[model samples]
Target: ALIAAFEARIRAQPVHVAAEVQLAATAAALPPLSAPVDEEAEAPAEEAIAPRAPQEQVRVRADLLDNLVNHAGEVAIYRARLEQQLGAFRAAMAELDRTNARLRDQLRRLDLETEAQIVARYQREQDSADPTFDPLELDRFSTLQQLSRALNESAADLTGLQGVLDDLARQYDVLLQQQSRVSSDLQDGLMSARMVPFDSVVPRLRRVVRQAGHDTGKQVQLRLDGTHGELDRNVLDRMVAPIEHMLRNSVAHGLETPAERVAAGKSEEGTITIALRHEGSEIVLQVSDDGRGLDRDAIRRRAEQRGLLKPGAVLTDTELDSLIFEAGFSTSEQVSQLAGRGVGMDVVRNEVRQLGGTVEIHSVVGRGVTFTLRLPQTLAVTQAVFVQIGETTYAVPVASVSGIGRISRERFESGTGGYRYAGEEYALHDLGLLVGQGPAKAEGQAQVPLLLVRAGDLRAAVAIDQVVGNREIVVKPVGMQIASVPGIYGATITGDGRVVVILDVAPLVRRHLAQRPAAEAEAQQQRHVPLVMVVDDSLTMRKVTGRVLERHNFEVVTARDGIEALEKLEERVPDLMLLDIEMPRMDGYELATAMRADARFRGVPIVMITSRTGEKHRQRAFEIGVQRYLGKPYQELDLMRNVYDLLGIARARD
Candidate 1:
């Protein structure tokens, strides 16, 4: 009916009446709905179901529940064994009871036999004078001898009972031994189950390094070695942030541009190698790059600027390298997506330590840098040396403890006086005094427990009331309220169920060293504020640098280019010249050569601060007697440190 109505409406439209009439004829010739539909219903249900077929399910990975179920079954098996052991123990106890009853009966028989012998002896003494009593006495004595023979038999029986008890005791020991083995194996298997491959973190690291290179306009070729090494899953997860941060640091601060690499007699591509491997029970990860290495002098100067060290404080190369891990410390002048916020390295150190790890750095002046992170495979357990400080108990990581000993009161010194150990002197830090407990019992003629610990490049002996030996402890995090407490890392429960704080040896040593009295002010005082020549074609560069130097109490001279700088030099030789690489006429290279040729300015220091951070530029600058090559967009601290260091000008303030 609906089709006929539609046909009639189409015909009334009049635009295509002939077509509409033909469609109506076709509709009228088709089979009507009232016709039997049995044939259509006879079609297969399978065909009507749209050819449904089963499809395999896709999953990202296997479910953890499967492994858990297997372990649960194994645990059940161990539980059954434990029940069997309990039954065996009960049987052994029953046998032991039976043996005890037999031994008690044997003892009673021996006591009765002994009493009969005593009675016979008394009768013999009373009948000694009578002949007729002789026969009776003989009978009584014979009875006594029989009783003695029975007592001997009872003694033999008692020995047999003792052997039975001993056998039961051995069986009990074997049961306990078997149970212990099963428990240990289960624990080891569980720990192993928690491990994962080190390369699990590589996919994310690759993305981070690639993005960093693109952002920095540098070509960094990253190669991973021993990626299949396994680590605890939790340790690997926590390590992601630190490793990613280090990778970003290498790309942004370590690697050079393709053009720069070529100029430095290196390949156009910069190479970063991340190698992982097992070192005994520990996992060793090395991140190394072939690039301009760390500048120790720059680091020392920066440390002084941050007030981490006094001006002109002398430190070894290793000590200087370690300053980078200080909180809120960074060398970059500008903040970017990658760095310059001064937060990465400290986080790296703290996180690594939380996993019972250490970070060591090695670098050469112009070759490259390598950061080595050594961590235990798992954080589930660790060996610690427990010590008692005042009334509090503390656990120090065994890895960080160098030695333990006792020092006589006469040999021990307070503060920076240092203590002698094995013919060597190291800084001595009294734990009590360091923690604000005042001087310890120094007047008493008693020996003090000294714990020698290594904190980075410095070794020091910490005085404590007592050394509590070593223990394997399960580390647990401290409450949030005390998370910021200095020198304490975490807490763990002792065997006696007492909670003890774990001491972070590194922070303790750092804290003590920082408290040392500064050496007397530098002997050499500057006669006057040093004069500096700021040479740059960019007016803004000249002004900024000049103003920075002036603020640091430096007399400033300005020049627009190398030609103008030479003119200024002719008038007077400045103590230092901060020259730019590119200029309108007679660029820095040519001007540097001119200055080297001059007799008066030959000894004067020339520092090149420029946007051209290529090795070729630096090599040329060095050849022309540039004392330092500082990259542009430099930190004000870096600039000041370099100026003060090169000019031999001591900081006026202590």
Candidate 2:
């Protein structure tokens, strides 16, 4: 057993030259007791065990210390450049301040000049009326008129100066825009320089996977896909332990033993696939295993044993899957090195949350289990959806924003009720009202800007005045005075010098729910509404279509892109489809073609709504079997008319 264990360890790790030489020497020095071994003609054991350098040693051309030094130098250079730019920006601001002061001085002089001219005119009229007026008084009035004329000339010059100043301000704004772009690029480049491939941690993860497989007496194969995908070095460093724990969980709990897998009609050797892919601005890392999958029954029973579930309370599959992340929660019967401690998963959840990432689990019993970790490329900067509520600007992490759309008040069955989004019912909160800025919507306003936010299992819509746009923002913590605010997560400075609040999603939703208990009941009643799937990447477009559909009494499900649309389709096919011509990943033509190929979706009516109005584009869409082609900025009535025609429903005229 000792010899076998030693051999296994040697096979697992690359042998060093010194160790190989020592092992050979020790083996050669041993006495040969068998006649067959003595008769064998061979070179000395030391020579036979040729000392070859490990593959990793051969592959490493430069020392890691040298690489670190080089990267540090690059970072220092970027810092210097950033500092210089900031100094320039300050100088420009000072110049602008001086120009403003001069403009103010010019305006005051002009005002005084006008008043003096009026007084001189009145004096002249009085002097003309008086026949006995002194020459000195007449001369004084004439001097005052001359002074006013000079002041008028100065005012004209000031007006030209004002034009120049206005031009300068416009130029300054342009400069600022350029500077913003440059700074963003510089920051991105600096971040990219710090990005390391997902492969960086794969070797270590591979070892852990192997060891866990051995300990559990299961044959497991680890395969990595898209290992070249880059992630921030700091984020990757923090991810090492959590990823290892997840892989261990896959091998220990997710994958069954050889016998069990075979009995379940699966291959004798289980496979654990770790795939890394870039999804828009985020990186998606999926750890999946093919084994006897998550046992929902066992998880429920364990939850009951631990008193996590109340008596006679039933939990959905989604809720049951989430229970595994609870602190001190485990389904394993016996404690082991890999799991059953119930400490790892909760730690994983906490770390992910700290990094502004999300971890989701999808399991199909007897098929497999998949754990997906969606993380931003870097935590220092995050893409956020900027919105306006009353006069305040707030930003929400893009990951939390499921969709954006306009919600018309006229669409609600009552004055205020719940709405359905993405085939799920969620309470809608008026952001302006919640923040005490004003009413949710201004009186007599036709539509409200709505943002769909999903945090964990909770989904809700927030009403804002408008969505300024989406951009990458560096978040800073609010001071202690307002840090305790329930829904305020840090704050960030916008390019135009506005300090925008970043919302803490989960808490904000909780606060909204607490304030309006009636919304919960309304949400329960929204399940029976007709669902419409709105697929478009633009936030404005999503809201526009959603609002139009809602106005006609249809609930809407929205997707940012065609890929997400397909995922939503897997969950629930909508009563009607509204697709855009151009989108990321998959466009309308491609989506339509793909859907037409699938028997399940062949009969679904697709209305191609897009800005691409070229005849060729329309012809191509028609060829792809789109039922309708609506041009950009279609009127509400026209859009509804087309939708009703396709869905065979009549729209009531106001």
TM-score of each: 0.52, 0.57
Residue runs of model 1 more than 4 Å from their true location after superposition: 1-169, 385-395, 402-452, 461-473, 476-478, 481-502, 510-654
Candidate 1, residue 574: Cα displacement in angstroms equals 76
lDDT of 1 by residue, 1-654 (tens): 957686778867989887877877888888897887676666676477776678974342324633553454445345545656666666656645555565566667766776666666666676564555544355544565566667668767866866776687678667767876776576567667677788777888899989999999898889999988888877888998999999998888788788888888999888889999886557889999998888677677778889998997887777788899999888887998897899999999888876767888998866789999888766665678887754477898876666887777766753447766677566777776555544344222268778887644557788887777886566667887877877777887654446788887667567655764421121122134467899987767988998898787787989878888887776667888898887767888888888889797888888888999988878888887889999989998888888888988776653
Q: Highest TM-score, which number?
A: 2
Per-model lDDT: 0.75, 0.75
lDDT accuracy of residue 273 in candidate 2:
95
Q: Give the runs in model 2 whose Cα sits over 4 Å from its true position.
A: 1-148, 170-182, 410-417, 430-439, 442-444, 477-489, 496-498, 510-654
